[model samples]
Target chain A: MNKKRIAIDMDDVMTDAIGRFIELYQQEFQEDLSDLRLPGRNLTNTVPPERLEAIKQYPHQPNFFKDLEPIAGSLEVVEQLHQRYEIFITTAALEFEHSFTPKYNWLKKHLPFITWKNIVFCGDKSIIRADYLLDDLDRNLKTFTGTGLLFTAPHNAHVTGYTRLNNWQEVAAYFLH
Target chain B: MNKKRIAIDMDDVMTDAIGRFIELYQQEFQEDLSDLRLPGRNLTNTVPPERLEAIKQYPHQPNFFKDLEPIAGSLEVVEQLHQRYEIFITTAALEFEHSFTPKYNWLKKHLPFITWKNIVFCGDKSIIRADYLLDDLDRNLKTFTGTGLLFTAPHNAHVTGYTRLNNWQEVAAYFLH
Candidate 1:
């Protein structure tokens, strides 16, 4: 049976979160945090450990969610895929306090087509079952048991192994074919 | 006076070396190294010292160069830029023995408009004095005193600092404007 469930990671996969965060951080702090490279996959390396922990403690930084820019072609791709598959927004950000509500609000505001019931915010996404997990993080792919499609991002595209895609159209082609 | 000389990196900026290497490595060794997570950028972990040394000593493998692909819009961009700038194909692949010859040959074969005389192979690129250096490697960008335009690749696109471009069209637009 072709499992039609599709799970997507939020940060770089759906929304340009890391890019927006770095832009905001630099504007506010006058500090360039773009070169802070983190090991592993995804936006996990955008901020230092201390800062990440601090953000987690107080997740409601004004305009943090508002600042998010959707990845190019994401809304269109999601809309197309949703027709054939059960789409779920499975993000690691769900683990942090006040994570889901703000993200949900952001999505609702930007993409009203995505239903609230379809979103699944959780810290650990590997535990959730799905046919395909489109993620920018390598660690998350390692944890996921399903077919993992690594979204090509500036950070994770160089990573070797796993299926790599330049954009969501490619992802749709891969699964739909 | 702005130096009219333009020095371009060979790897991703000129020829698709990494793409070819990954393709061959997979075809020959059945080793799929598609992950963008190269050692220095991600993980505190290092590739085994022996493996690293082996790669260093491996007589710059030119097998991939035999079928190198030109990055999108590279020829058009170079042609347009050449009208206003003295274009130099500067690369650090000379350390790999005669590997650069094939790369040169491939460029000439594919991009016949680019003259071989304009190409300069050096052991280190940053030391080359030029008005501008278009490179994809961040390390090399740091070493150059000239204005640098980084070619965005799947892996290094996440780099925070420096001017980035997705394709040669973007590069041409930047320099021409």
Candidate 2:
């Protein structure tokens, strides 16, 4: 039987990217950035409008995209969902040249069941065709024609529209049921 | 500049699948199959009709898709072309699950630069949006809205409508020029 494809984004969705960024900022300034807030409160939106370039440079960091920890229960839920549907890790990476292998290696290590063929490294998510997309950024989901689930993130907490998923277990229950 | 993507088929375009199939058929019946002509011939249209079921079993055989040798000069030309265009290995593999990893490993070994993200193992080519597609069958290219170059194969040799490429040299010259 042909299975419906569920495309999942990497940053802030599967990977605990916000946690890492907050931790990184805390280490640099020696201050608590966990309470840091954004003006628009979108994960994709940078604070003060000046740190956008700096935020883009994080992927270029040695292990920024590589060493990110997966959200709690994400790996287990992914494995469970993999048995029932075709799960694709559809991520946008055209902006980062050095992020290719690091992200590839991270998926290989963390989500070994997802074959390299199922992983898509794309620039624009608009060209991608899938049944559902789990992402934190509204930009990708806004343009996506499929069912876009706004996976919960720090900044996206204030944003609305489309279904919201607080965690991986919720995603599993939604798709599996 | 966003370069045009050139999607190439895996079976006959990259690997010598036609040569292997003809050789396998010749060895099985201990007779000449090379003299067999094709205009209405397809990858599934095995002569005598009795071999049709057996032809479908080829993908299940271990190393069937893995062990095929690369076409002469295909690799070198691909290397040269990789510098000029965004090359993707667009292959149809839903009919054969065992073929996925083998094809992936083959490309990794043979064409390391073409990352897993660029390689697409798809069933239907209709949704694929590439600037150009180099394929062995008319069914794939016929649905493609982009320019299609039918790479020469025993099954597709007699078919017409799209542009035909006899070898990798022609492909490089067409795209590189």
Please provide, for model 2 over B62-149, each residue's C-alpha lDDT reduced to its tens digit, 9 standing for 90 to 100: 6678767998878999889889887877776534645656777788899988875577655556545678889988888887878999
DockQ category of candidate 1: incorrect
Regions more than 4 Å wrong, model 2: A1-149, A153-177, B36-46
- Which sections of candidate 1 miss by over 4 Å? A1-177, B1-3, B37-59
Q: In model 1 chain A, where is the ten-residue run with the lowest total lDDT?
A: A92-101
Best by TM-score: 2
Tens digit per residue, CA lDDT, model 1, B1-177: 543878787777877766664565456557665553352332112223444454333335646456577787887888888888877776654345345447556756766665644555444443345678888888878867778778887557567678887788789888999
Give each candidate's fraction of reference contacts reproduced.
Answer: 0.00, 0.08
Assess each model's interface with DockQ, reporting 2 decimals per model. Answer: 0.01, 0.10
DockQ of 2: 0.10
Clashing pairs in 2: none
- In order, what are the TM-scores of chain A for the candidates? 0.77, 0.87
